[model samples]
Target: MEISSPPRSNATDLLVSTSSDISHLTELLTAAGLELGPGGTDAHRPPRRVLNTPRYAAMQARFDRFGSDGITMMCSTAGLQVCLDMGERDRVATRWAALHALGPVLLAVFANSARLGGRSTPWVSARTRAVLGTEPARTRRGAVSGDPAAEWAARVLDTPLICWRHGGPDWTAPPRVTFAEWIGGALPGVPTTEDMDYHLSTMFTPIRPRGYFEVRYLDSQPPQDWMAPVALLIALFEDERVVDEALAAAQPAVGRWLHAARVGTADPRVAGAARAVLDLGLRSLPRLGLPTDLHDEVTRSLDRRLAAVPAPHGGDLR
Candidate 1:
């Protein structure tokens, strides 16, 4: 598929959200006869017919056909790829801005498998669980560092690969083989730095800092809901005051990342975090020149989801 890059300013930063089991979700899309590329899965893909032209009509048609299957619409600005660009001092800041900005938007846009095991799951976002289950280092929320690029590079070197897609078959590497190991001749191909970079790209995580940090932890939301997260992210990050508010709001629930994904809005901690984040997002919306209604709707949805389900057991939510 030809992926058209968004405007440079918009595409510079990226946020990735994945279903609980993205591989399975990809399979689902394939079964539905849709091909997903590096961008998103199934209905989430930009309509093939609309490339290089107005997307409104085609986007609407795709939504009409498959929006209810829990397809999420995400945004990526051209700015995100600048990590590969040299002479950028504010690269990490831009990435954090994107991530912080996208948090609530992601929450709002979240749509995922409502059913699992051939039955309707109580949670509206089962994809969150699926992605969480895939890998811990990549999906789990780690300590956000001051420099996302450096932090991501260091972490990438440490995270072991789940599987490597070689030609036609996936060669399963040792679970403990870190990027550092591969780079330092552990894998024995005298891997180059470029190869190491490519390897890092393959390790899917919630907060990854390559050329850009991909926030791969959200369930696909409806198409109409796409702009909410995009707008929210841009607002929160670009504006200093909004960033402060967001961090404050996110702090309360920072510890609940696992619970939020595992039990979603059900876990009280997760609920609290959702509420806090939503509250902050609403307060900041006006300042960012975005709509507060989006914030309100998202907050309401999370509240309802939390109230309806009981928290799951185990070692934190995915």
Candidate 2:
């Protein structure tokens, strides 16, 4: 289902609506000689195992230009699709900047991916680090501007174009060519505005812009514990006063995305801010009137994080 406006959208209602839909989907998949893989059930499974068909090969080939080399039949990574409702259009850019800033702490709090190539990986969220390790500029935290659309438009043009459609055997771009340069008659024919928009989608960042602010850093969690991060996100942003406190709490950890992904909560600064953010989310639970059971589950998830932080060489939480 689609949730265009989440604040204006009812969480309970959306859950009721989507639960049945998900169930139906599960049944259909089961009937189609397919089954749920050990993804959410197990953290060690490959996050993105895709079917290597020609279409997928082309897609992976494009990513290969960046730096990805894995072979599988279907893509499989799961994470909460979180969107914070910001009511006014006028302040979107400013609000987006604020949300974008909170990304590192969130990544630390929900750093769940501990596996790569079906075995334990060094990074707390190896999935995230691996993605960031790709074409550096495009994979890091995205840019923020006072005017989001305008800034995003500029970012799309300025970032290097990965590959474009053509009747050639190779889709690789010329060295040091950017979409902006292409627009100015650099190499291949100038692309349309729609093409530029498509290029923006290819770039990955913590915060992806939609009508509601989308946070993309949280890793795929255990199926039972997935809702906590989503709740944390909502509780932090649902009220203006809470938003201010959370932002201030996250100040020290700002721009520390790589650190957060690597160290998880063991990084002292991220741990402190994460504790504050988790505590703040707990405080807002009553006020927001979210489902008690789900919120309680979220509380348990946060409690585990506070009690144990991932160590660099050891997988044991302490």
Candidate 3:
């Protein structure tokens, strides 16, 4: 279910070619009486292997208190996460900041989930809305500052634990208890390095930093259009200059997660910012050394998206 490109390889090109395999697989499944898209109905009833696992059991137990949002997110929705290198150590802060700044625009641009539980929803990215509604403490976007590493470390320790491993069936941490409290002997056992590693894996922040940048904001794209966002992101973050330019272009929509998920590019302000970001990404694409046809495919995808919106909202990309 996952495809990883080799290190320093061209992700856009790989996605473009790999899509054929995906399409073929989809056809095979369809012939066998299977259908596939963004949403699914199996959230309420996961497979035994998935549901019976200690990790999932504990997670479900913890999320039960929050209502059905967590279950819906885990069961129904799909995402097209893009992971990239953190780049040079000195430039990490800049890249991190730029990604956060550009996140809302990206979310709005690729918003796809419009329905949940067989009912039409107001939000464009209903999956994202479900994520925010489930748990803000651990799932929301992390605060950006000059010191990302320190801020992230502190945030990790301060946030309440979802679950921790134990030999017994019950892996759920005590309600409202944080990892910091466990480290201070609030729990029966001492915290270890492995425990810290597991804790990091539990974080569901919009952008997860684990020696690499995991862009988790994007909704799963349609099969034919999957590579557009990937190419645009690569181009935007490929150079410092592009990152700064894209960040400024998307500044108007910064921190507007709810708005982006609700109205998407329908809002003139968000639409304007999205247009500029897409244009900037397009302008920077040539530097990526993509093949002519592949580059044109990306261009067409971006153009199609831009043209889909009303003129009043989608201003000229120039």
Give the candidate number with the greatest TM-score. Answer: 3
RMSD of 3: 3.6
- Could you give candidate 1's per-residue lDDT for residues 1-318 as a string of tens digits? 222233334311332222223445667788999744321233233223333322333222333333332112212101111121212565456446435443433442344445443455554455554444445565455456566666666777787654443343335565567767876776756656666665665554555554544455555444333344444445455555555666665653454444453445555445555555555655555554323565465446544543444334444334
Minimum summed lDDT over a 10-residue window in model 1 is located at 74-83
Identify the superior model by TM-score, candidate 1 or candidate 2.
2
Q: Give the clashing residue pairs of candidate 2, or none.
A: 49-74, 50-72, 50-73, 50-74, 50-75, 51-73, 51-74
| Candidates 2 and 3, the one with greater TM-score | 3
What is candidate 2's CA lDDT for residue 104?
A: 79
Ranking the candidates on lDDT from highest down gives 3, 2, 1
Q: Which parts of model 3 are misplaced by more than 4 Å?
A: 1-8, 20-24, 38-50, 312-318
Off by over 4 Å in 2: 1-8, 28-59, 69-78, 86-90, 144-150, 167-175, 303-318
How much does each candidate deviate from the true structure in C-alpha RMSD? Answer: 11.7, 4.8, 3.6
Give the distance in Å from residue 134's predicted Cα in candidate 1 to where it truly belongs. 1.1
For residues 29-100, could you state the per-residue lDDT of candidate 3 as single tens digits? 789997556432222333222457778777777776887777777767778788877888787888888898
Model 1 scores a C-alpha lDDT of 0.46
How far out, in Å, is residue 44 in model 1? 16
Instruction: Give me the displacement of residue 174 in model 1, in angstroms.
Output: 4.9
Cα-based lDDT at residue 279, candidate 3: 80
